[model samples]
Every structure is written in C-alpha cells, then in structure tokens.
Target: MQLVVGRIGRPHGLRGDVSVEVRTDEPEKRFVAGAAVATDPASAGPLLIESLRWHSGTLLVRFEGVNDRNRAEELRGTMLVIDSADIPPSEDPDEFHDHQLIGLAVLTPDGERVGEVSDVLHQGQDLLVVRRGKTDVYVPFVKALVPIVDLDKGILVVDGPAGLLDPDAIV
Candidate 1:
C-alpha cells in the first residue's frame, strides 16, 4: 500500500529544487538523499531524491533527471508516497497510523453504532471521516470527542457533544 508522505511545492531556484509540503512526521527518514518515492498520478515518477535540504524550516528536494526550474515546476503538486510496509511502528501508544484507524468501527459511549472510519484528515486539526450509510460525518479526533480507541476490539468510542453525530436531533 502506498502512503502519501508529502506534496511537491513550487520550485525553489534556478536549479531543479522544489519545496515540499511534508505530511509525514518522519520527514528526515522519508526524505533523504538517494531515496526513491512513487508519485500519485503514476506518470510523474518514481522520483529519486538526488539531494535534500531544509530551507528556513521548509524541505527542499532535487530529484534525479530534473535539472532545471522548469523540470521542477512540472513536478509541482505531485504527491510523494512510500510503501506502507516501509513505515516503522510508532513507539508511542497514543500514536495511531491512518491505516490502523481506517477500518475501525465507530460507536457512541453507550455502544450504539455510529459508523466506520473511512479516513483521517490531518488539517489544522485531526478529523475522523466516519461513513454512516451513504454520507460521511467529520468528527474531531480529540480526547474529549473520541475517548477510546479499542484497536483490539476493532472499535472506537466517540464521546461526541450534542448534535455532533446527528444534526437532525435537537441540541
């Protein structure tokens, strides 16, 4: 399984260096010299990292064969992905990979089934995308909202606020 690690941003300079919008926490391990990562569109590349450096807190990478600014610009917005098998397990118990959360059943504190986790969005806040019927509900993945993650039981308990799970219900 391919997991997205980062997205190629704008070209940095006259050379084929592009800034990266990193999605993974282990950027140092994932983005390094001579690392080859797969691309999203499939046509862009299995880009080989010729070199990488941090420029003012931003990760800048130059891929092999991409020697000019135009070549780097062409790779803009390309998602850099690695095999899921390549990811090392987190030592922290609280840390859960997106793959680990994806198929887990979501339930209320009372054990009423709400949905199944379809995705986890990592924006400014982490949001769990729970699929209920044909629709998807975005639930904030915080301790107050999601108190329990019973991975062994394949379920997670949601301690949602009023009208959070059901909009039609009176607040």
Candidate 2:
C-alpha cells in the first residue's frame, strides 16, 4: 500500500527542481535526500530523492536523473507516494486517514442504513460523500453529524436531521 505524500506543483528554478505541495504530515522525514518515493506512473519508476529544501513555505525537491527544466516540467501534476508502512502509526483514537473511511458503511443514529462513504473531500471543511443506490449525498464530516467512525466495524454512525441522508436532500 502506498500513501500520497505530496503533489508536484510546478518547475521551481531551471536546475531541474520542482515545487511540491506537501500532503503528508511528516514531510521532513519522507522528503529527505535518498528517500524512496514514487511519483505518477507516467514516470519510469519510483523517484529517488536527490535533494530537498524548504522554500517560501513549500518544498523544493530534486529527483535523481532529472536535471533540466524539461525533466522537471514532465513531473508536473504527479502525486508523490510513499510506502504506507513508512509512515508512523497515529496514536489518536479518533483521527483517521481519508483512505480508511472510503468504502465504509454509513449508518444513521436510529440504526438505519444510509450509504457507504465513497470519498472524503476537504474544501476548507471536511465533507463525506456517500453513495446510496445511484445518487450521492454529501454530509459534513463534523462531530455533530458524524459521531462515531468505527474502522474495525467498517461503520460510520451519523447523527443528522431526518431526511438529510435521503438522496433528494443532497441536491
């Protein structure tokens, strides 16, 4: 399993360096020199971190064998992924990665089945998009609405107003 660590933003300077929008919590540990990371499948193989530095609050990185502006440009829009095992385990009981929530069944507080989480979106606020039948419903991933997220049981208990889980209420 691989976890996305960052996204290739754009070519930084002319020396084959690219600006990366860090996505992981531990950027310094995962984006160091000689660190093994994989970019988009378009690239030949996993990227070898040649060098890394912080610039203007973002990460400036150079991958091995990519030594020109053209090479850096080729990596734009690529997502950097690292082995999931490389990331340190989270100690927080309630905290979870978005990946873990995907595909989990959503249940209402009244023990009614609502839908399954299709994806977790972050647009200023966290949102859980659930798929029920052919329609998709968007629910705020707040403590008030989502009271319990049991990964072991593969269930997410929602506590929203009646009809909020209905497909017609989503539009």
Candidate 3:
C-alpha cells in the first residue's frame, strides 16, 4: 500500500534542495534522510532523501545524485510516495485511509442513501466529496457529522444540518 507524501514544487537553491508541497501529516517521519521514495512517472525516482529541512510551511529536500539546482529543476511536479510499512496506522478505529474512505456510500443515520463518496479533500480538515444525482455535495468529515463508518458494509452515516446534502440548498 503506497501513499503520496508530497510533490516537488520548485528548485530552491544552487544546491540540489527543492521545495515541496507536503501532503502527509507526519513529515518528520516521512521526509527523513536516507529514506527512499518512489516517484509518479516512475522514472524520476525512487529518490533517496539525502537531506531535509523546513522553510515556513513548506518542506525542502535534497536527493542523492541530484546535487545541482538544474538537476533538481527537472524534478518539479514529481510526487513522493512511501510504502504502508513506513507509516503507522491511525490510532482511532473509526478513522481511515483516504483510499478506504473514498467510494463509500453516503447515507443518513436511518440508511437513507445520499450519494457515493467520490473523493476526500484535505487541507486543515477533511471533506468528503459526494456525487449525488447530477450534483456534488461537500460534507465535513468530522466526528459529530460523520459519526459512523461501516466500511465492511460500505456505508458512511452523515448527521449534518439541513441543507448540507441538498444540492439546491447548498448551491
């Protein structure tokens, strides 16, 4: 099970260091030196983390053999990934992997079908993007609203306020 950790933003310095837009919650564990991460195109890597640093909220990393800015420039837009073995599972049982949450059926507490979860968008918090009929619904992935997740049954129970799942009300 591979997970996306970050994406190369731009070449940072004359050295091989490049800026990255981090997508993972635990960067210290994921972006450590000596760790090897695979790339998207499957040609840019598997990149070895030669060094790691933080500038503001962004991550800066240098890879072995990519010792020049020009070399790093070629890696812009590259995605960094790690295996499931490298990451720890969520402590909360109800919590889930993005892959697991995606595609689950969204329903009310009484089993009223709302839609299917198309995606899980995360910024500071997670939001479930649901495809309902001809429209899309964005539901906050909070414990209060999304109190139940029966993955085995392929269902997500939403108890949000009125108009949250209504396309006409939301849009």
Candidate 4:
C-alpha cells in the first residue's frame, strides 16, 4: 500500500538540492530528515531523506548520496512514495484515498447498475469516471449527485438526472 507523496523537480542550486511538488497535504510533517521514501519509476529501492525544507510553497529535499546538481537532475520527475501503513489515520469517513475507489461499482439511486469507476479525476472538481461496456460516463462527485458511497458493498449510489449518461448531457 504505497502512496505517492511528491514529485521530484529539476535541481534548484549547486548544493545537491532538488525541488519537489508535494502531493501530500502535510508535506512538512511527512518529509522529515532520515525518513524513507520510495522514488519512481524506480520502485525497487527507497530513497532516504537527508534534509528537507519548504521553498516557495514547494519542498526542497536533499537525498543521501545524491550530493550534486547532476545527481539531483537525474531524479527529476520521479514520484515519491511511502508505505500506506505509515499514513496516519483519518477521522473523516468520506475522506478516502483515490486508490480505494478505483475499482468500485457505480449504481443509480433506483438500484440500477450503471458501471464501474474506471478512474477518479481530480481537476478543478473531483469526477468519478465510469466505464459501462463500451460507453464512458463522467459523474461529478458532488454530494447532491452522489449521495451514497457504500465502500463495504463496493458500490456508489448516484442521484443524477435522467440522460446524465448520454453523450450530449452536461458533465
């Protein structure tokens, strides 16, 4: 259960420093020195954080053994991950990770099976993209439209209007 935390950017200065686009909400608390994080597309080994700090709302990190501009440049665009077991528990029941909803089934309020959630898009608004046979539908994740999300049953009950799945319907 590895979760992505950040993405490494290009070298910032000559002191083996690289910018990171923090994806986690608590970046400062998560990217502490000596903490271990996995980097991708190399997923076999984990990178140890030697130092970390905030810079312009982004994270600046220096990893052990990567002490030069060239070394840091090579890690650009790599994603940082941590074991999901290390993630602190959340009190909010609705705050589910994107990975948890990837394969859940979607149904209408009337108990009609709609489709399976193929992907969760996080743009300006969160969207649950469903795939039904050959048809793909995008459903907004607003409470008014999605009233029930039964994770235990592996299904989400939506309350959208008629023709919401039609190609011409407003997304």
TM-score of each: 0.81, 0.78, 0.88, 0.77
Find the 10 residues in a row with the least total lDDT in model 2: 36-45
By summed lDDT, which 10 consecutive residues of candidate 4 come out lowest? 37-46
Candidate 1: segments with Cα more than 4 A from true spot: 133-136, 167-171
Error of 1 at 122 (Å): 3.1
State the lDDT of candidate 1 residue by residue for 70-148, as single tens digits: 9999999999988888778789888888878999999988999988999988888889998988877889889889989
Q: Please say which candidate is ahead in lDDT: 1 or 4.
A: 1
The digit string of per-residue lDDT tens for model 3 on 1-171 reads: 677879998998899899999877677877889988899878899999899888886788999999999999999999888776755668989778776777799999888998999878787788889999988888989999999998899998999888889988943
Q: After superposition, how far is residue 166 of candidate 3 from its true place, in Å?
A: 2.3
Q: Where is model 3 more than 4 Å wrong at Cα?
A: 84-88, 133-135
Model 1, residue 163: what's the lDDT? Answer: 78
Comparison by TM-score, 2 against 4, better one: 2
- Model 1 scores worst on lDDT over the 10 consecutive residues at 162-171
Clashing pairs in 1: none
TM-score, predicted candidate 2 vs. hidden true structure: 0.78
lDDT of 4 at 19: 95
Cα misplacement distance, residue 13 of candidate 1 (Å): 1.9
lDDT of 4 at 95: 76
Best by lDDT: 1
RMSD of each: 2.7, 2.9, 2.1, 2.9
Candidate 2: residue 170 lDDT (0-100): 36
